[model samples]
Target: MASRAGLPVATAHRLTGELVSWGALQRSGQDYLIGHRIWQLGLLAPAHQGFAELAAPYMQDVLFVTQNVVNLFILDNDQVLLLERMSGTRVGAPIPARR
Candidate 1:
């Protein structure tokens, strides 16, 4: 991982330890995964908070009318991320967004 990231092994190890202590990473068996704290912080971003507030009413309307599922998405580089998801039905599979 360090070599792939172009960092020395020792430096990567130290930085990884720091991130773990800072609640940014969590040990998962032999690997590290994003921690809940990082997710929480991401939600605190102004863009995300504003978009969520702005989309709330529309999301509710979709649920009220369709009685299916409503998902909010935003473009990130070349991919779309599911910013918010409100499900009115439980049976359908997830569909990827494009743009």
Candidate 2:
């Protein structure tokens, strides 16, 4: 959205703060993105995680075959947590397992 609007960094920061305070966005580290409240409200409609868990094996097989990055994400309060990720290179990136 900032990229589309061509907003300067200060303006973006201010706008993001407003949104976050209003429960529309979440500030995590230096990244301003979506918040957990939205995810919880959406999940209440169909129990999204349970269905995703059941399908994870099939997804993992495809990801393994392709040797590509696979990520499963979850929201925790103001933070977006990575539940799972499959990567071949262990040293180049700063991942939770490596850390």
Best by TM-score: 1
Number of clashes found in candidate 1: 0
Cα lDDT of model 2 overall?
Answer: 0.68
Runs in model 1 deviating more than 4 A are 1-6, 77-81, 87-99
1-99, model 1: which lDDT tens digit per residue? 799899999999999999999999999999998887898888878998789789989999978766668889999899776788888864364544546
- What C-alpha lDDT do the candidate models reach, one value each? 0.84, 0.68
TM-score of 1: 0.64
**lDDT tens string, model 2, 1-99?**
577779987897788788799887887887776787765577665546675677589768856555557677778699775555666434354444433
Roughly what TM-score does model 2 have, to 2 decimal places? Answer: 0.35
Cα deviation of 20, candidate 2, in Å: 1.0
